[model samples]
Target: MVRNRELLSSGNAAFAGLASSFSELSETLDRLASVADDRTAARAAGLKARLEEFSAKITFVGQVKAGKSALTNILAATPGLLPSDVNPWTSVVTTVAINTKAPADVEGPTNTKARFTFFSRDEWDNLVVGGGRLGELAERSGAQEELADIQRQVQAMRDATKARLGRHFELLLGQNHSYGYVDPELVERYVCLGDDVTPGEGNPQTGRFADITKSAELFLDIPEYDVSLTLCDTPGVNDTFMMREQITLRSLRGSELCVVVLSAHQALSTVDMALMRIISNLENRQIILFVNRVDELQDPAGQIDEIRSGILATLKKFNIASDVGIVFGSAKWGEAALMGSYDGLSADSRKALEQFGAMHPELAGRDEWETAWNLSGLPGLLNAVAERVSEGAGKRLLERVRRNARNLTNEARATLMARRSGGAAVTVDFAGHSASSVMQQLAAKYESDVAEVCQQLRDDLMQRMQSAESGFVKRATDSLLEHLERHGESGTWQYDPTGLRVLQRAAYLSFARAMSAKLSKLYEDAARHVEAIYSAVLSEAEGEFRIEAPHAPRVPAPVGLGKTIALDLQSTWWRRWWQKRRGYEAFAKDYAHLIRAEANSITRDLEENQVASVLENARAILREFLKEHQETIRRITQPDADTAEDARKALGVLQAGTDTGAAFGEILRGLDDMAA
Candidate 1:
């Protein structure tokens, strides 16, 4: 177990660093923005927005029916807040935020309410018409059966939506709208059982919640914990098709830690392995492998050992460098036990417990059962998570904020240098050419060099992206096509989500995994390009001037870019949600074209815009140097007192904000405040 004192100290230290750094950086940027031109101000605003958007992400991931929702309840310490019995196929991403301080606007004792966001009508129509991108591609390739299956699923979802939503169905499809302040008492009414479509008088019984809601969020004050925590309950990895899975993966990219829930009965299943592999690929993220339902095992200890060994072996085989903390427990028993109501267990669960007791007469007593139930490892798990958050996640978040501050500090220093050195500009005559002409020639040469490096980078990275995109899409398309070709109409929907739509869902998962790899590569490639460009530009500029651009920070891994392509591509409703803007028929007819077009568009967005943006920023550094020399000489020679005052004020603002010692002092003070 992580030491509580260590965790507290770490949290205080990290939070202090973050608060002070951000405060200083924000002040400096404000000062800079006041004096900067419109273009520079806009760019600074963009950077500021990015920094402000930094929030600690915690993602919950696991396989279908692994009691992930139950685990969520345990983590939140709010039993039954989320529907534990929700259909796994409906991949709705739910988020729960615990406030450290109660809201001033709210009247009561930190009341919990959920705000549900629904999908637009256009998105649903697109999914119906296009049959999703993979389905459409399969259809075009003469895979009639696969297309028909997709059409059937679409029709089923549409029919279910109408039956469940009734008149309200139309209300939800309009746009990205919110339905909020829903009482905690009726949380289940909004999230549970996708097919519960019966309409009631006052209570909205008829709601296509699974179909409509893209995501839901719950906010409440948890007075127990000292630190604020936001927990995300995501869809099971194999719950839906490709699209929602990708969304979950994209969400994971931002998360500091991932708690992977696994069922003891089926430990390290294929889908579990896939999900584990995904998290392992993510750099600088912590992981916890939680094996739920351990109470069901005949020999819990032996089974847990076997499960752990298997997981370790598989992770090694996959070459994942993750050190996962393994927790063995039963989410069901733990939740019920925590609520102080063992009778809350379903009749089926009660019967199962009885059978287990009968199987082992030696352990058949209320005391043993109580101990078993309490020994659900719930307390230990919570403590571990909190420690990790305080020790690792908090520090990482602070470090990222500091990196942004450092970058801004470099910018401020360069601007100061420009202002100070402008008066001492040197001019030289070279080979019958004027100093300005020679400078222009040098700029032109470096510009070409910059362009060449950028182009080569684009060529290499874009090719890799294109190759992966094409191959994965084709493979996914081909799998569905072949399945249809092989088993025309024999597939049936089973009670288990993994059983129903198995072929298509499996194909979707495979494709999603491929796309994730592709996306990770794209981010890695872009980061590399950014670093190379900055280094090259800095070298070239150093030859002429002392001013240089800041080193590129470790860019966060880019996810969700493939999400820009044609459809949700997931077996779930994300495809429906994503296609909100396009007409169904047009999307369907040109689905393949749309897929290719979207891929190209994303590639261009990254290869052209993103790469160019950073390089352009680098060039701005060089331009600033040149401009500084030119302006300073003119100002010094003219000796305008009024202009000098304005410059001095700007310089003063920066100097006050950029005091390293003062900032560190504030950081220390902040730590003291946290301790207090």
Candidate 2:
């Protein structure tokens, strides 16, 4: 075993450096808290808590048989941990938490390392009765035969599951299983789709429980990486049942980075266009396209450039941004390099490795295994991920921590100066009742304003969505007519839904931009109102104390809006629907109505689910901000006896020629240096 030759050393070093800085920042805050006032100490503690709780979440997504699990295993440095040959019917979403604690909701012993959650009763009923999203789509398209087919499949799955688990199936719903240890057999029992043994039988390692499993979470302590990482392996997008597609989309919404694995032989097929649409919906996520199984190519060294070019061209043709990093490699090569099993490689793979080495002469002088590792492209991929982490979440966290620290230190200095002065204690005459009343009025006004804004935005978005739907119906109807004239509708006519997807994307983007701008302005206005109130009340005080306004909270963009509609599905039901509708004029007219109804459902989902949620969260955040600042005002205007005594003690310590002021100044300077 090559223990020291870890492929993730570079990325691990980057994360370790950032973790060290975070630790230092936390320690500095602790030191400041010991000698600071109550409010400053609380602020420092909050900053430290945020530092400790930060983690980067990355999700791996791709179609079925795209080598996602294989690539995930190689990246996490735990080869063979996940089964690479998952069946298409498997719907489990596996998450690997590296150097991070299990989620708070997970209940288990301290030694528990794996948790498998089953679907709730409601969720199972939805899949069975509602037929998931595919049934909805089929009904909207008036494809009765297709809808029945979907329901039949669902019923068959339910019956098979009941037979396998007997009466324990219902008992397992809404429950989770935890294990103190994990192995391949343990993982396969919950994640794989094989059905050799029954669940209620004496065989405990059967995959019969896999169908009802919702998620699998594995916690591992990998010492190579110093920071926390959550790697989620979502089910493939091309499942026949389409349940995994919904699961995958939900996973994407929670992730900050996405690694899209593609089979090198069929890099980007038409079926993968849904994946493209999903990627396009990610607002500020970092995406890397990894073309796996390149070792299967006859001449990887000679074919890599052409493959890269073709993939880039496809992206450009689709109007996607060109900055998405693309890397070509084979996970098998990485596994071999990790285990130092060069002798086990086939002759052709060995020859290809040699050729890869010759292509990059810089590695000729290094060990052959090292060269093979580089040829795997895992090193490059890791470096790219590290770079993104450093520039994205890591940078933002460091900035926020430094800003809060400086502000707290400045406030502490102001408090000290006020205490040291021999002047009478400054006090504002604003009563607590009056402050509460004023805040209530402001909160009511904010609520009213937000409601009005959301209503208007909703109306505008609905109009746009309707228009897009009408245009798509017209175009699709015309296409259907053309197909009828050409082939008399005897055979199936399959039309691309890319146009509808594009229009829907435009509407979604418009909604995102408008909501973001309006809500951000509202947040700023609310902050200013509170600040103005503070300024007015504090002006009545007699001292020259300086109090900075609270920092404005960042408004999050509307989420859960990237839902993949049924129209984007490339299932056979679409063609079957067309074939069932043989007449031309009636087919076009009925199809148009069905499409219009689907559009209505889509619009309603956006308004009620996505838009409504955003507005509610925004209001809650605004309310919290106002409430905190109100408390702050009350604390400053009416300091308790304990706080006054603490201030006096701090002032006396300062009077004894303590270097507290100089220390604060040094901390400020350090913050400035970090900002630079």
Number of the predicted model whose TM-score against the real structure is largest: 2
Q: Each candidate's TM vs. the true structure?
A: 0.58, 0.87
Worst 10 residues of 1 by lDDT: 492-501
lDDT of 2 by residue, 148-266 (tens): 88889999989988987999999999999998888778898899866455557645655778989999999887767767778899988877667877887777755668888898888
Alpha-carbon shift of residue 13 in model 2 (angstroms): 5.3
Instruction: Go through the candidates in order and give the clash count of each.
Output: 12, 0
- For model 2, give the 10-residue run with minimal summed lDDT: 542-551
Supply candidate 1's per-residue lDDT for 462.
55
**Residue 531, candidate 2: alpha-carbon lDDT:** 57
- Top lDDT prediction, candidate number: 2
TM-score of 2: 0.87
